[model samples]
Target: MSLFRLDASILPGTSSSAELADLVEAEWTAAHPGAPVTRRHLGTNPLPSDAWPLAHTGNLTPEPERTPAQREAMALAGTLVAELEAAEAVLLAVPLYNFGVSQHFKAWVDLIIAGAPVGSPVLKDKPTILTTVRGGGYAPGTPREGWDHSTPYLRRILADVWQGDLVIVERELTLAGVSPAMAHLKDLADDLHAKALDAAREAGRQLAAK
Candidate 1:
């Protein structure tokens, strides 16, 4: 089985989501031995911000009339889509940025939609894992209960739009230990971290079974 792992953390070295994803990938490799794992680290090497717009316009224009940049953008979109199409499973490590999807992730999603036919389910029932980490708790009744805008968007794209058999592993209060203001929640954060790790391993096992 082949795995396609995409990371969208601007700070890879310190990303909680990446840490969980590492656990997921580790479990996957343990299950599949020598299976190939393709990686795309959008944080370090992001798609051009202008690519999606160019691709969108290119698709609307006649082939002969498309500019070079448009053609390149279209080709890039095709490649991104091709990666997902070729993978047997997917692992996306996406951390919330300012309560919403990271800019890099949003760009990738836009380009993916632009590359594929309209209303296409890119994942189409393939096994997929999304490990999303947040710096604060947003559970019901919390001060930020309705402030988290990232998770729902992620679900809408990966599960609803792409139609993947998705499983999400989320960890909140990730900054409890690091931020003085959240220090009091450190114990809870540690517990959540442990649980998220366990969930990640479980998700990995599920992906391997696929």
Candidate 2:
């Protein structure tokens, strides 16, 4: 089985989202034993900011009439979609940025849709997992409750738009030990982080079985 994994954390080693994703990958590797994985690190190698618009134009333009730039943009989008099409499962490690979805992740999604053929369900019913991390607490009763805009938007895109069988694993309070203002919640953060990793591993195993 093949897995396509996308990482959207700028800080690779220090990113909680990346850490949780690693746990899932580890479990998947153990279960599949040498399964091929396609990795896309959008945080480090972000798609062009204007890629979505260019791809949209490319889709409207015929292949022979398309400009070189538009062709390149559309080609990139096709490559991204092809990876998803080839995978049995997909994992996205997304970090909450500026109280919203990462721009890189958003652009990637836009390009995928633009590149896909009309009415084609490229990702329909695919087993997909979204592992997300937030620097602050956003649970009910917390001061920052309702501030988590990223997760909901991602859910809409992955589940509603792509029709993926989506599973979400979330970790919050990631800045508890690092940010002085949140130091008091360090223990809680650690517990939450551990739980998220455990859940990710379990999800990975379940996905492998499927």
Candidate 3:
């Protein structure tokens, strides 16, 4: 079985997404030995953050070749598509930024969610897990909540790509300096890690069975 881990954290060295990937990969590898894993860290070593313009262009003309940056951006896009095509399970850790996924993460999605195949997309029918970490909690029914664009957008996008089941684990109000009403950040992080491991194990078992 093949698993693709796409980490979209702008922070260097210590991103919540990276942490989840580490935990998920460890659990999956322990459960499914010899399974191949392809990890792509987009935030730290991004290919290029200019996919918006290229993807939106109406004309298919060569457009004067491309600058170095454009070329890298296209290559990254191709790499992402190829990875998606080969993987059976995908784990996307998208920490919330300003109530939504970071622009870098969105750029990666733009490259993969092509507007073809009304029902079956490259990501079509693949199981995907989306994990988010925030300084505060945004669980449904909680006060100061109800505006979670992270998983909602991902659900729609994943539906278009793989048409697969999308799972989300959200960690909110985990940072310091928020109203005492919010949960402790450390405790939330701990709990989130545990839940993420469980989800990863299940994901591995499910994918292996398939």
Give all candidate RMSDs, comma-separated.
0.6, 1.2, 3.7
In candidate 1, stretches whose alpha carbon ends up further than 4 angstroms from where it belongs are: none
Q: Mind giving the per-residue lDDT tens digits that candidate 2 earns over 1-210?
A: 989999999998688898888888888888899889999999899999988898899889888999888988999999999999999999999999989988888899889988898756777999998899999989999988999999999998889878999999999998888899888999999899889988998888877777
Who is ahead in lDDT, 1 or 2? 1
User: In model 1, what lDDT does residue 129 have?
Assistant: 96
Query: What's the lDDT for candidate 2?
Result: 0.90
Higher-TM-score candidate of 1 and 2: 1
Model 3 segments more than 4 A misplaced = 62-75, 114-120, 176-197
Would you list the rank order by lDDT, best first? 1, 2, 3
Candidate 3 backbone overlaps, count: 12
After best superposition, candidate 2 residue 74: deviation in angstroms? Answer: 0.8
lDDT of 1: 0.95
Cα TM-score per model: 0.99, 0.95, 0.76
User: So what's the TM-score on candidate 1?
Assistant: 0.99
Cα-based lDDT for every prediction: 0.95, 0.90, 0.66
